[model samples]
Target chain A: MSNPVSERGFEPARHAELALLLEVAGTPKPGNVDRRRDLSGLCFEHFLTGAVGSAAGLRLAEDGAPVGEAFETAVAGMSKQGGGNTQFGCLLLLVPLVKAAVAGDLSPEGATRAAEATTVDDAVSFYRAFEHVDVAVGDPPGDASDLDVRRGSEAESALRAEGLTLSDIMELSAERDANAREWTGGFARTFRAAESILNDEGPVTDRVARAFIDLLTEEPDTLVVTNHGEDVARDVMDRAASVSDLDEAETLAEEFVAEGINPGTTADIVCAATFVALERGVPL
Target chain B: MSNPVSERGFEPARHAELALLLEVAGTPKPGNVDRRRDLSGLCFEHFLTGAVGSAAGLRLAEDGAPVGEAFETAVAGMSKQGGGNTQFGCLLLLVPLVKAAVAGDLSPEGATRAAEATTVDDAVSFYRAFEHVDVAVGDPPGDASDLDVRRGSEAESALRAEGLTLSDIMELSAERDANAREWTGGFARTFRAAESILNDEGPVTDRVARAFIDLLTEEPDTLVVTNHGEDVARDVMDRAASVSDLDEAETLAEEFVAEGINPGTTADIVCAATFVALERGVPL
Candidate 1:
C-alpha cells in the first residue's frame, strides 16, 4: 500500500484497521460479524449506503415496502441536507474510487500517469476515475421536486428500506453559505477507499510505522531529499500539523501516530515510504 | 470489518476497491519529506497546492523563481487529451473537497454531524460549512504563494523526479477506456467496485477483490435488504428472470459482487449482513 504515513508518521492503527476490515469482509463461512463494528453502531459503510438512498430520494411505495420518488426527489434527498446530512455527500464522492479499482480503472500505468501528470485537471481526472461514484452520482445534486409532505415521507421510507439513511448524506449545502470560498462549489465530497484498502479503516502499529517516524523533523525543508527520507518527512509534518499544538519535536512525532492521520493522505505516504525503504535497502 | 464472501455463496467482487490503489501507488520518495507512502506521488500535492493558488490567486514575490507559475504552467503543459479540458464543469467540483481538507475549513464536528444526517436537507447546514467562507473574514483558499515552488530547475525538476516515466503515464491513460464507463462523468450510472470489477476486470478472488466488484452496483437496497441469503437469492432471481439465464441463483450471487455496487450500498450491506451473521456467531 502507499504510505499515508510518509509525511506524518507510521501508524499500526492503519494495519489494524485493514486487518479488522479484511478479517470481517470475507464470507460467512469465515466467521461471524461483531456488533460493535456491525449495524448497531454507524460506521463509514452504513453512513455511505444511507447517504445513497437519501441522495436519490427513494421513497416507499403505497404498499408496505418503499418506492423510489422522482430522481429529483432522490437528488434532493442527497443534496438538500438540512442539519445532519453528510452520508450522501461523503458517499457520493467515495464509492467511485472503489469502483475505479474494481473496474481496473486504476492500473500501475494509470497511477503512474497520475503521478507524473503536471496538470491539476489530469490529476483530478486521474483521481476522479478512482472516486466513489454511487455516492457521487447515485444521488446527484439538484433534487428539488415540488412534492408534498406525505409523498416525501414515502420516498424517504423507500430509500430507508434499502438501508439508505437520510442522516449520512453530504448536503453540499455549503453552496449556500455566503461566507464560502470559491472552492465551495466543489465542497461536496465522498469517502471512496483507495484501491488497496477498501473499507480499510485506520492504522495501528507496524515496522513501516516505527521506521518512518524515527525520521521526521519540525522543519520540513531542512530534511534530506533521499527517496524515503524526504517524502516521509513531509507526510509526518502534515499529519503533525493537522491537530492541536505539539510544542516540541518529540511531542509532534508522538501525536502523529496517536491521533492517527487522514486515511487518504497518510496511507499513501506511509505505504510509499515503506516501499522506498525496502526498495532502496534502507537499513531501517 | 465486513464480509467479502457471503454465506449465500461466493459473491462477486463488490465496490470495495481501495486496495487497487495500493497496487499502483508505488513507493516513491520526493525531497525533504518524512513519514511514508509518497505512494500517490508528491507531484499531486504540488499540483493541488497550485490549484489552491489558482483559487486564491495570491502572488508572493519569491526570489527570481517563476515558482508562482510552476504548477499553473505544469497544468497548462499537459495535452488537453485531444479535446477535453479539466478546468471547467464537473472537473471543478473537487476544488471544494480538496480545499476544505487542506485548509481545514470543513469542521470535523460539523462533518461528523452531517455524516450522520438522515435527510439531504437536514445535512445541508453541515455541508455548507465547507463552502461557507466569510469574504474577508474567512480563510480564503491559499494561493500559489502558499505553494513552495522554488526558484531553480531543481525545484521543478524534483517535482516529478522519480523512477516514473512518461510512457508509464501514457500506459495508464490508455487503460482508461477499458475501465472508465465514460470519458466524461466516469461512473455516472453504476458506481460499485464489484460492477467495475466484473465489467472491466474479470473475476473476484479476494475479499478485497469482491468488495471492489460489489462497489459498482450503486443500489443501497441490495446492501441493506438483500444482504441476507433470502434477499440475495430473490434479487438474483429477479435479475435472472429479466434476462435469459437458468442458473439465476448462482449468477445472482456472483452478480452482487460485480464491481459497480454503490459504496453506500456496499457499506450498509457489509454492515448489515455481517451484523446478522455475527448475531448468529458464525466464525471465520
Candidate 2:
C-alpha cells in the first residue's frame, strides 16, 4: 500500500514507538519502569521488548490499516514479550494518534476525530486486545457488566448489537478510565503534558520524568485508584505534587516502588504526550 | 514506495533499531553505555535518541534504497542527536545486514553479497558519512592516504578514480578496523556472537552482556587499539577474559569508564550480533 504518511517524510509510527522507549527510559518516573528500576513482575528489558515488538502494528497503522486491526495487532505483538500489559494504555492512546497522523494531522482535534470515526469492529478489536494481556481495570458500571473488558472477545456480540463504536465504548468508560477519557476528551491532558515536555530543559528523558510527575500531581491516576482506593490515589497525587526536583522525585520513586504504587495511567499519558512532543519536533 | 520487506511480514529495520536499543540497554558492558552506566561524554539517553533517530534511514534500507545512500542517511539521522558517533560503526554493519534481510535472506553470505555488490558511488556515500560524526580511526595506510575517511567528501574523486567500492575501501581497513573486518570476513564474529547470544540463558540483555564479554575477551577491540595502543587493547582483552561474572564485569565497567577505555568496536559488533539474534528468534 502507498503510505501517504511515509510519502510526507514523516514517520508517525516511529515517533510513537520512540515515545514508548523514551517514556520507559525516563528515570525516577515514580513507580513506573525506567532505566534504573523495574517493578516486581516487570523488568526494564520487557519494556524494551514491548516497544520494539509493537513496531509492526504501529507500521500497520502508518500504512492506513483499520484502527481495530492495527490496535489488536499492536497489542498482540506487544504482549509477545513477557511484560503482560507494558504499554496497553499507551498504545490505546498512540494507535489513534498514529491514524490521525497518517490522515495528515496529529492535533488533539485530529486524534479525537479519528477516535470518533472508529467502527464497531474497532471496539471488538479493542476488547480482543484485553485477551492478550491482563490489564488492571475498574469494574464496569452496573449497566455495562456484559461489556466488561475482562470478557475480551465475549463482549463482541454485545458491542455489535448495541452498535457501539470504539469511541462510544470509550465514552462509557470516560468517567473512570484515564485512557478512555483521552479518547472522549480530545486528549487534553496528553497535549498539555506534551507542551510541558517541550518546554522543559535538560535531557529528553528528564523532561519525560518531569512531565510524568506533573501529570501524576495534576490527576489521581485511574490505575492507582483501581488498585488502591480513591483515598490512596489522592494521597499518591498529593505526594507527587510535593516532588520539587529530580532528587526528590528519585526518593519518591523508591517509596512508590516499594509500596507497589504504580501510577500506570499517568505513565500512559506521558507516553502519549511524548509522541506528541516528538511529532512537534522536540529535539532528541 | 512499495516495501517488499514489509510486504513479506518482516521488519528488518525495526529489528536493527531494536538491536541498537537492546545493546545499549544491556547492563555492565564494561566500557560501553548501558542501563546501569554512561560514559562521561555520552549518556544512556543519547544512545536511545540515536537508536530512535536512525529509524528513517533504516526504513530506507528496508525499502531497497542503495546501500551507500541508506548508510549515509542513517549516519546523518543518527548524528541528529547530540551524542556524536553513538552508533556509527554499528550502522555500517547494520545497513548491509538490513539490505540483506530485505532481500529475503539474512545469512552471512547474503550480507557479504550485499556488501560486495556496492559501487564507487557507495564508497563516496560511505566517506560522506564520516563527515557527520567524529569516528575514531587509525591513520590510513601510506598507499591510500588520498582516500582517508577524515577527508570525507573530498576523497570522492579519488575513490571514483581508483574504482574503489565500499567493500573495497573496507578491505583496505579490514586489518585495522574490526567493523571493517566483519565486512571483509563475511561477518563471522557477528554471526558467532549471535549464536552465543541465542544459546545463552536468562534475559536477552544478560545474554547480550555475556556475548559482549566473550567477544571482548576473544579479540583486542579495534577502537581501543586506535584510541589507546595495541598493547592497551590486548590488556583490555586480558581484563575482559578475567571477568568471571557480572559482579566482576561491573567492577571493570567502573574502571573502564573512569579511564576512558571504551571498547567501542566490540560494542558495535555486539549490536550487529543482536540484530542477527533477534532475526533468528531469540525471544525478547
Candidate 3:
C-alpha cells in the first residue's frame, strides 16, 4: 500500500494549524497556557478553539494570499470563539511561513522573502486585525504613534500615507516585538529552535516543551518585558534557565500562572519553530 | 468592516476537525484522554496529533467523498502519528456528519441519509483501514467470520460478494457498536447529546465533560462492554450517574485512568455530538 502521508501529500495549511495546536498542547512550557495549566483569563480550550478557527487564514496563506490579509483573517477567525487573542503573534509568524512552505521552500530565507514581499495593503489588514482581539502591546515609540496597532483601522490612513509595507512596519517594531524581529531578521531564532525541537528525543510535545524552555532561557520574553518590564523579564528568563527537566518546569509553570507572569513571545516563537520542524519532517 | 465569521463563511470541515480537538481537550471526562489526563499508552498529545492529521479526510468528507472513503482516509491519517487508534471511532461518526453539514443539513436525519448512501467500495475502504491501527474490537460472530474487520483487506472479496454497503455492515454491527448504531438509528443518541451540550452553560469544554457524564449515566459504554463485559459496563454507568458536578467527575477521572477503564464509545458519541453542536452554533 502507498504511504498514506505521501498519498495525502504535504499540506502546509494543516501543518501550520497543527503547529498552533501542538504548541499549546505541550505540557510544562513554563508561564504560558499549556495542556496542564491555564492563566486567569486564558484556558487551554481557548487555544484549541483558536487553532481550529485559524484554519481558514492558514488555507488562504497556502493558496498564496497576501501576508496581511491571511494574518488578519487568521486573527479574526481565531477571535471568533472569543478566546481573546490566543495566537495573534503565532499567526503573524505562521502566515508567511506557510506561504513559503507552499512555494516549495520552508527555510528561514524563504519565510523572510515572503514577509519582505508584503505591501501597504497588508499593513492595513494587519492593523485592522487589532479590532478583533485585545492584544497587549507596548506603547509605540513617539515617532510611530500614528501607526500604533491599538489605533486599529484609524491608523490605516497614516499607514497608506507613509507607504509602509507590513514588512516595513515589522522592521520598525523589530526591537520591541520578537515576532516582528523574525520578519526582519530571516526568522533566525525560529529556525534555530526548530532544529532543537527536531534533535530532541521523546514525544513531540515534550520536545516542544524542552525547546520552549531553552528559548526562554536564551532571551527575556518580549511580552513579559511589555507587561512586567525588563527586570521581571530578566528574572523570568533566569527562572527558565534553572529548569533542566519537565518536573522543574511544572513547578515553574504553576508559579508563573499563579503570579500572572506569561512569557507569550517565547511561546509564539515556539509555535513558529513547530511549523518549521513539521515542514522539515518532524513526526507528529 | 465585514463580520469576520461571515467573511470566512461556514466551514463544516473545520467544524468537524474542531469537534475532534474539542472532544479530546475537554477535561475530566471519566476514563478517556482529555486535556489534563491520559490512559496508559495514549497520552493527550497523541489525540492532538491525531486530530491535526485527520484534517485532510475531514476536508474530503466536506467535499462530498464517500463515507467509507473519508472515514478510512481519516483513520489512515490519524494513525500517521502512531497514536494507536486515538480517534478511529470518532472519525467514523464525524465523516458522515461533515458530509451532511456540507450538504446544508446538519441534522441527524441528514447524517443518516449520508451513511445510508455509502457504497460497497466504501465497505472495502473501511476494512482496509484496519491495517493502519490496532483497534480494540470484540470478536466477530461465528457466522460473520468472512467479513471480520480484523481480516482487513483480505475480507474485501467477501464484502463485495455479499454486496454489503458500509451502512449494511454498520447495521450488522449496530447491536454491538454504539458508533455503528448511529448509522443505523439516525444518530438519535448523538443528536440528543448535542442538544444537552448546547444547553449547558459555562466553557464549551466543561459542557462537553458534563454531557459526557450524562451520556455515560444513560447507557453502558459499548467499548467498556467489549473490553470488560456487561457487568463492568453497568457498574461504570452507575458510577457515572453518581457524578453530580465537575469535582466528583474529577475523582472518577483519576480512578478510571488508574484502573485502565476507558469508555471510548461514549467519548466517540460525544465527539459526534460536538460536531452537531458546533454546526448548530455552539460558541467555542
Candidate 4:
C-alpha cells in the first residue's frame, strides 16, 4: 500500500480532512448534507471547518494518544470553530481510521488493532466528548443500564464499574448504531467500500458518490432511523438503491431534503471509506 | 480582527489552505478554473491536492523560515500530490500572507514588515522555487539581463551579484506580475478586497466570487495578458465588468473557459483576500 503521508505529501489529519471534504462535496448524496443541500441548520462550510479543525487531534492519535480522546478533542475544536454537530458521525469514524492508517497498515486487521488498543481512559474521554456537541443518536435500549450518552461523567463511572472498554461498549450498541457497528466489527464495510472506491474509475467525487449509494443500499441509515423511524430509513435505503444515474440521485437528494431525511451515519461510513482509499493514494 | 488560529481553531497553514480552497471553489470566476470549469489540463481536484499538500510549507513560513523556500517547498509538495501548477500564483501570495499572519498583526502593515524582513537567501530560494512548477508569467523587460526564470540558478547568481532581496525582485516584476505586485506593495488591493469581503454579508464563496469579479474588472489580468494578448485581456476585463450577478458571471465563465482565456492572476488575488477574511473569522 502507498504511504499517503510521505508519497502523497499529506499528513494523516490532512488525509482525514480531504476524505471528509470529498465525502461532503460529493453531490447528489441523497438524504445527506451535500453540495446541493444543507439540512439540520448545517451547511457545507460547517463541515469544512470541522474537518480542518479536527485534523490536529487526528494527528495526535499517531503518537499513541487514546483515539477516543482524540475524537473528543477533534469534536471540541470543530465546535469551537462552528458550533454545530456537522460531521460528528464522520469524525467518529475517521479518528480510528486515521489512527489505523498512521499505525502503518491500511487493512481491516490494522484498523481492528487500532480499535482494540483503546483503554478505559478512551471510554472516559468518549463519554466526555458528548459534553461538547449535540450529536444525534437513538435512545439507549430499554434493557440497558448506565449506558446513556446524556449521562456524561456518570456514564463514564458506570462504564468503569462494568470494566468495559470503549470497543466493548461499541459492541453493545452495534445493533443500533452504524458507527458503533464499524468500530466493533473493525470497520469491515468501510474496508469493503474502500476496495470498491479504489477499483472504481472516474472522478474521485463520482466514485465516492457511487460508494455512498452502495453503502446506503446495503443498510438502512441509522441516523434516519434515529431521527425519523425505521420505516423512513427503510424507504430511504430503497430510494438510494433506485438511484441508477446522477440525475436520479439529484432528484432523490432534493426529495430527501424536502422530506427532512438525512442519512448522516452512512455518510460517516463513506467518509471512513474515503480515508482508507486516500491513505492508499486514491486519485482525486 | 478575529484571530484565526486561536478563536477560529485553524492553524496558519489551514488558513492558507482554506484561502486557496475558497478562491478556487468560488464559482463563476470568469476565465479562471473555478468549481465549474477546468483549464490548461488542470482540474479542480489538482488544485485541491496542491492546496492541502502546500499547507506544511506555509506553516514553516510562520516559524520565521525564508518565505521563498516556503514557496518552493509548498510547490514541491503540491507536485507530489497532484503533478501540476494549479495554484502556484495563489501559493506565492499565500506564503507571505501566512508568514505575516503568523507575525501577529494580521494586517497589511504586518504583511509588509514580513516581506521586508526577507533575506538574500530568500531571493535565491524564490528563484529556485520557479524550477518546480510551470507558473504562467511574462518575460522580463528588454533592459533586464540574466533575469530570465528559465535560467534558474543563473538568475539567483545574478540576483546575488546585484545584492537584490526577494522583495527587490518582486518590485522589479511588479509592473507585469500581479503576484509580484502584492509582494512588492504589501498586498494593497488584497487588503481592500478583504475590507469589501468583510463588509459584505453572504457565503464566503459568494463573497470571494464577487471579489474575484471586481478585482478582474479593476485590473487587466496579467495571466490572460501573458497567455493571450493585451487586447484579449482587455476584452476579458470588459466582459468581467459586465457581470451584474452570479448567473451572469456563470455565463461569462463558460464563455471564457471555452475560449481558454484564464484570469489566473485575479484568482490569486482573490485567494489573498480570502486569507484576510478568514483570518478575521469570515463565516463560510
Candidate 5:
C-alpha cells in the first residue's frame, strides 16, 4: 500500500481500486451512479463492493495471470457482493490496463500490446466472466457465429472452435462497444482523457467530472443506445457536448436520470482514464 | 485482498481504507468533509491521500506490531502526503482495534485489553505522532507535568521519565478528548455504534450517517468545544439531536459549515465503529 521498498515494485491493484473509488466518489457525474445520487437497483455501495471485490484478482494480473482470468474472478467476487452489474465495463477496461501497468508500461501502446496478446484461454475466461452478472453488451455483428453472451460456456466453445482470441472477439465488437473500441484501437480516447485529467485545473473529483462530460460528449453511449435507441443516445451526447457549466450538467443529469438515459459506457471510460492518471502519479 | 484461503486471515488494511472512504463519501455529513462539501484548508483529496498513506502501517499493526509504532508510522506517512491531520483520531482508535482484530478480538473488552497492553515506548511513539499534524486537543490538566502536545519530543521525554504507558497518557487526556475517552473507556460507544450498524436495515452509508448523527447528538463534540466553546458545542449537539430528517440535517449542515463547527471526534468514533462492523461481517 505504501511505496514499495523491495523488489515487488508498484502495486497496480491499489492503484486500480483507488481509481475506481475516485471515479465513483466524483460528485455531479451526470447520469452515472456517483456520490451525489444512487439509482434504485444500482446503489453507490455496490460499486464500493465491486472495487474491493476486484482488488485481489486485479493484482493477480501483475503476477502474469491471463487478464481474462482476473476479469472472471473479479466479476464472480462482485456478484457475490450483490445482484447487479455496477462496474462490468470498468472491470473490462482495467484488467488489461492493470496487466500493462504490471509490465511497467501504461501508455496506449502498452495497453494495445497487452490486449493484442490475449489467448484463446483468455477468450474462454472472458466468456466465463459474463456468467455472473447481466453486463449490457450490444447484439453481436450479423457475421459472428454463436456469439450470444448468455450462452456462457456454449459461447466459449464456439469461440474456441473458431480459434478466436479475446482480442479477436473485441475487434469484432469494436464497431459497437466503446470499451472494445478502446481495446482494439489502442485506448486512444482514454489516453487523451488521461492526459487532460493530469493537466486539469481543479480538484481530482472536478477533473473527473469534466473528463466524464468530455467523454460523454464525444461518443453516443452504447448502453443508452441499447436501452433506449440510437437517436436518444446521440441526443445525450449532444446535450453532454453543450454543457459548459456543471450546474447546467446537473440539471441535465436530473432529466437524464428521470428518462433512464445513463451514459454508463462513458463512465466506464472515465474509470479507465482515472486509472491512467493515477498510474502516472498525478497528485490526485 | 481476498478472504483467507490459507493461514493469512482477513486483511484489515483494505477494510480500514474502505471505512475511511465510506465515511468521507457519506453525503451531507454536516460540518465535516463529506462528498457534498470540502472545507477550505482540508479538501477531500487530502483525506484520500491520508487514507492511502496510512494503509501500510495499519497493516503492520495487524501483523502484531506495537500499536504506537503503527500510529507514528501512519501519522508520519499522512504528514508526508500533506500538511493536515485528516484522520488522526481515527488512527488512534483503529491501531489498537486492528491489533485486537489480528488477535481475533474486536469487541470493547478486546480493544480494552489491547489498549491496556501498551508500553512506555508506545507512549513515546504516541507523543511523536503529534509532531506530524496539528490535531485538535484541549489544554492538559493543570496538574500534569510536561504534557503539552506542542512540545513533541520534549513531552515524550517527560512521559518516559514519568513511566507512563500510552494508555496512562490516554487516561490523563480522556476527560477532554472524546477519542482519548474511547481509549480509556474501552471504546464503549464505538462498539455500541458497531452493533447498531450491524442491526440497521439499510445501505451501509445510510447506517453510517445515522450512527454519526446519533453519536453527535450524544456527545457535544470535544473538537467543536475546543474551537467554539462549550455552549456552542452543546447547542450543536441539541441541533444534531433534533434531526429526525436527513434533509433537515443537510440544511443544518450548511449552517454548521458556515459557522465552522466541525464534529471531528464523532467522525472518528464512526470510523472505529465502521471497522468493528466490517470486522464482524457487516454486509458493507
Candidate 6:
C-alpha cells in the first residue's frame, strides 16, 4: 500500500517546473489552453436546491432570460432526438441512472429523496453512495490543499448527470442560452499579449479565454469550425495582434519561475500588465 | 439604431443563437482527470464587468494572495525580484478590459461608472463609448458578419517607455535549468488522486465537467510524471499492463469529437473514462 502505483510516484512538481520553463522559454500561457470545469459553485448550490425542490432552475444568459418559459420548451426540444444535443441531453432522463446513483432503485420514495437532496450537500451525499464502485477518479488530480478547488474524475460524472437531467427537467438550459456568441453581447472577452508589441498572440487572458469559451459554447455541430477558427487566428493573428503588455508580464513571470522567486513580486508585475490592458479597455 | 450592437434589437438575437448552441452542446462534467478553476469568474463568466475591475479580480488558484504579505518568505530567498510568484503570480491576475469601442479614455470616474454596470449594461455603455473614439457600431454578426477579433499590429507601440524597471518581474527568456530532467513534489498528487478515487468515481453514473476541473488542479508536473510515467511504463513494462480503461474512454471521446460532438461533450465522455479509472483505483 505504501508503494506508489506499480508505475510509482509521478512528480507533480514537474507542472510548476514546466510552467517555470515555459516562463523562461517565453512566458506564454503555454501551448495548452486549459478549459475549466463547472466552477460556479455558488449558483450550483442554488440550482441544486432548486432541482430538488422545483426540479429545475433558470440557466441565465449574460444578458438575461429568453422570451418564453425555460423548462417546457427545452424538454420538448431535447427529447425530440433531432436537436443539436440529441443523445447527450436526454440521457439525463434515464430513471435507472438516477435510481442507481441519486435515488437508488425504482421507487417514488427514491425520486422524492433525490429531489429532496438536490443541493450540493445532497450531491455530495449522493456521491458518497459510490465509494465501493470500481471506477477511476479520472485524471487523478491528487491535490486538495484547498477544499473547494481540488478534484479529478469520479463524482463529477454523477453530478453532471444529475445536473443535466434536472436542468432538462426544468428546461432553463435553453432560456439561459438566449445569448451565445455576439461576444459584445453580455459576455465580452478582453485579451492582452505579454510582449512589447500589442497584438493577439499570447496566453489566455479573460478576453482570449472568453472568446475561446464562447466560440465553442454548445452546438456540437460547430466544434471543428470554432476550433479551427480559433486555431487559425491564434497562429496567424495572435503574433500580429496580441496584447503586448501581457507578453512583457509573461516574460517577467518566466524569469520569476526559473529563478524560483517569491510569489508576491511575480503577482505585482502581472497585475500591472493587466491594469494597463484594463486601462486600454481591450476590445470585445 | 437597427444595428445588432444596439440592445433594443439586432445584438440580442445573435446572443440568443450562440446561447442556443451551447445549451445544446452540453458542458457536461467530464469523468477523468481535470482541475477546477474554482473562483467565481475565472473565465466564461455568465455575466459581464467593466474592463478595469474585471481584469483585476482573477486569481490563478484559490489560495493566491498579494505578493508583499503572502510572499514574504520568497522575498528572503529571492532578489528584489525573487519571490515565488512575485512576477509570475501577478500575471495570472485577471483584469477587466472594456473595448475602446465600448468605453474609451474615460476618466477613472467614467470608467468606474461603466464598470459598475452589469454585462448587458456594460455592453450598452461600451457601444456608446465607441462614438467618443473614432469608431463605427459595425453590423451585427451573421453568416457574413465581420466583427473582427483581431487588432492592428501597432495598436500600442506608442505606450512603451525606455528603461522600464520592474522590481520582481518574472523573466521568460531562455536559459539552462539546474536539473537535467525537471522534477518536483509528487507525493501530494499521489495522495490526492488516491483519496479522490476512494471518495468519488463509481459505476454507470460519473459526470464529466466537474471531474476534469478537479484533474486540472494537480500540478502539471505531477501529470508529466504519472502520465508520462505510464508512457514510460508502456515502453518498459508489459505492453498489456500499461494500457488502461481510461484509454478506452479517451478513445471514445476522440471518436465522439471526430463525429463532431461538442468539445464539452468530448470532455464529458473522456472525463467519465478517467473517473472510472480512478474509481477502480488502478495504475497508481
Predicted complexes: DockQ each: 0.01, 0.31, 0.41, 0.33, 0.23, 0.02
* lDDT (Cα, 0-100) at A172 in candidate 5: 82
Report the error of model 1 at residue B45, Å: 29
Candidates 4 and 6, the one with greater DockQ = 4
Off by over 4 Å in 6: A1-197, A200-264, B1-253, B263-284
Tens-digit lDDT track of model 3 for B69-148: 88888888888674577999999999988988888887878888899889999999999988888888998899999988
- Per-candidate TM-score, chain A: 0.22, 0.96, 0.96, 0.94, 0.94, 0.18
Error of 5 at A174 (Å): 1.2
User: What fnat does each of the candidate structures reach?
Assistant: 0.00, 0.38, 0.38, 0.19, 0.16, 0.02
- Root-mean-square deviation of every model: 26.1, 5.4, 2.8, 3.8, 4.5, 28.0
lDDT tens per residue, model 4, B176-215: 8988888888799999999889988767778889998899
**Candidate 2 chain A worst ten-residue window by lDDT:** A1-10
Q: What TM-score would every model get versus the actual structure?
A: 0.19, 0.91, 0.93, 0.94, 0.90, 0.20
Candidate 4: regions farther than 4 A off: A1-9, A143-145, B1-9, B143-145
lDDT of 5: 0.81
How well does candidate 1 score on lDDT at residue A194?
Answer: 23
Report residue A201 deviation for candidate 2 (angstroms).
1.1
> Residue A226 of candidate 5: its Cα lDDT?
82
Where is model 1 more than 4 Å wrong at Cα? Answer: A1-121, A127-206, A218-267, A277-284, B1-284
True contacts kept of 6: 0.02
